[model samples]
Target: MYVVKSPLPDADLKTVADALQGALVDLVDLALVAKQVHWNVVGPRFRSVHLQLDEVVDSARTHSDTVAERASALGVSPDGRAATVAAGSGISSAPAGWVKDSDAVGALADALGAVITRMRQRIASTAEPDPVSQDIFIAVTADLEKHHWMFQAENA
Candidate 1:
């Protein structure tokens, strides 16, 4: 942890930072998996799914950066290295090989849904100890829910 002093108590910051670090791991892994699906999706909807996946990737990367930066700002070192994400992320493992368009869409939606669920829990957990951190989680969750809806629409 760094030495910066935040109005939030050190204990509260530590709790919030730990929660954000977990969310960071999920966001990093989500970005990688979204790109993997983007690159490997095949079928009549290939181009459309591919393009949409790019948007998903962009959103995941953006959320990951924000979560990491927030954690850092609170004086904690966020563990967002690829190895850490691979090992610690709560999101499910994506398939190793190419996937069909529908399969990729379903997988991505499911993954995003998982992150949203965990994120909501993290958000609620901060209600008393750190409402600001809860606010960050709420913002990220809203964006992720939108993406999840889009991904689900791809399947419908």
Candidate 2:
């Protein structure tokens, strides 16, 4: 951890930073998995699903950057390397072979939903000790929930 003399205690910052790092790992993995879906999707609605996946990847990347920056600001060095993400992310591995548009939508929705659930927990964890971190997670949760809805709606 680097030097950061914030109002929040060092211990609290460390805890929050750890949580944010975990979030970063998951978001990075999600971004990669979304791109995998984008590349491998096939069906009558292939073009639409393929395009929609780009939006998901964009959102995941945005959140990953935000989360990593927050951790760094708090004096924690976030590990976003592919190995770190693969080892630490909560999201499961996507299928290797080509997938139907509906299947891709379902898989991405499930992955996003899992991360959103975990984000809510992270938000609550920081509610008392670090409200700012909580707010960041709240914002991320809203974005993820919106994406989850879109993916589910597309599948339907």
Candidate 3:
């Protein structure tokens, strides 16, 4: 009756894998939202904001792949379905229709920060501790922080 394969040991690997899956979901959602904003953005700073959104989405997509691959390495099937991701992600849903460039950037930055925080917490909670998880969290956190700063700078 099991739809998804069982996860690895109930140890740090499993914990990191589970957390990676959650991070994957958040990244996928954030990527989609970034692209949505990128395509729909208008106004004076349209070109700049749209380009930035593209960069963010690309980074999110890369992170998603890394996270999913990590999950698979831990003996778990990666849940890449939209419904599953949407249900698992802690990131807020994007509003309908065209949104202001600033609003879109703000929303994406907030989501990225939240995901990075969650990843940090999970990485800290690992019992046996995996270096890969720590490495991934550190890399992702730096990327998210950069994006957050870039978004904030746009407002300045």
Candidate 4:
């Protein structure tokens, strides 16, 4: 049964909903990965890397909420369950334990890159169907790209 009605046509809603759901999955996974790395990171740059990881976790969580709310507003349910994220996230798996600071940096950089890439795709796809959602995607991509650049600089 449909509780909320979407403003967009069915076809457009499908595309926008898919994009929002994918974003929620990736953002949730990104926060989890950053937290895991923050806990296990070791080495000379531990302090800096650990702090940076927290920033990523915060951003991911904040943005995930925004994406989910946007989906809800569009009459789509956002799924960010662990199973959904594990199955659909664009991010790769984190190491089991004791990740080196450098590795953690690299991993997060890669994670942000993955999310940003998909977000860009979503932005393009939603431009015509749902410019509002497209705007969210653009903002999210910009934020993730900043973290990605910082992490890459860490390795430089």
Candidate 3: residue 98 lDDT (0-100): 86
Residues 1-156, model 2: lDDT tens digits: 257555778788767977898899889999999999899999998998898899989999998889888877776788999889889989989978999988999999999988988898899889888888888899999999999999999867
Per-residue lDDT over 1-156 for candidate 1, one digit per residue giving the tens place of the 0 to 100 score? 357666788788767977899899999989999898888889999999899889988988898888888877777788888898988888888877889999999999999999999999999788888887899899999999999999998778
Candidate lDDT scores, in order, read 0.88, 0.88, 0.78, 0.94
lDDT of 3 at 76: 71
RMSD of each: 1.2, 1.2, 2.9, 0.6
Candidate number with greatest TM-score: 4
Q: What local lDDT does model 3 show for residue 54?
A: 89
lDDT of 4 by residue, 32-130 (tens): 999999999999999999999999999999999999999998888889888999999998898888999999999999989999999999999999999
lDDT of 3 by residue, 1-156 (tens): 234544434676567767778888888988987887787887778899999998889899998898887777666778889899879888877757887877877777777777778877766755346666667867876887789789878876
Candidate 2 yields a Cα-based lDDT of 0.88
Question: How many backbone clashes does every candidate have?
Answer: 0, 0, 0, 0
What residue runs in model 1 are displaced by over 4 Å at the alpha carbon?
Answer: none
Candidate 3 wrong stretches, greater than 4 Å: 1-9
TM-score head-to-head 3 vs 4, winner:
4
Candidate 1 deviation (Cα RMSD): 1.2
Candidate 4 local lDDT, residue 140: 93
Which 10 residues in a row give candidate 1 its minimum summed lDDT?
1-10
Could you tell me every candidate's TM-score relative to the true structure?
0.95, 0.95, 0.87, 0.98
Ranking under lDDT, best-scoring first?
4, 2, 1, 3
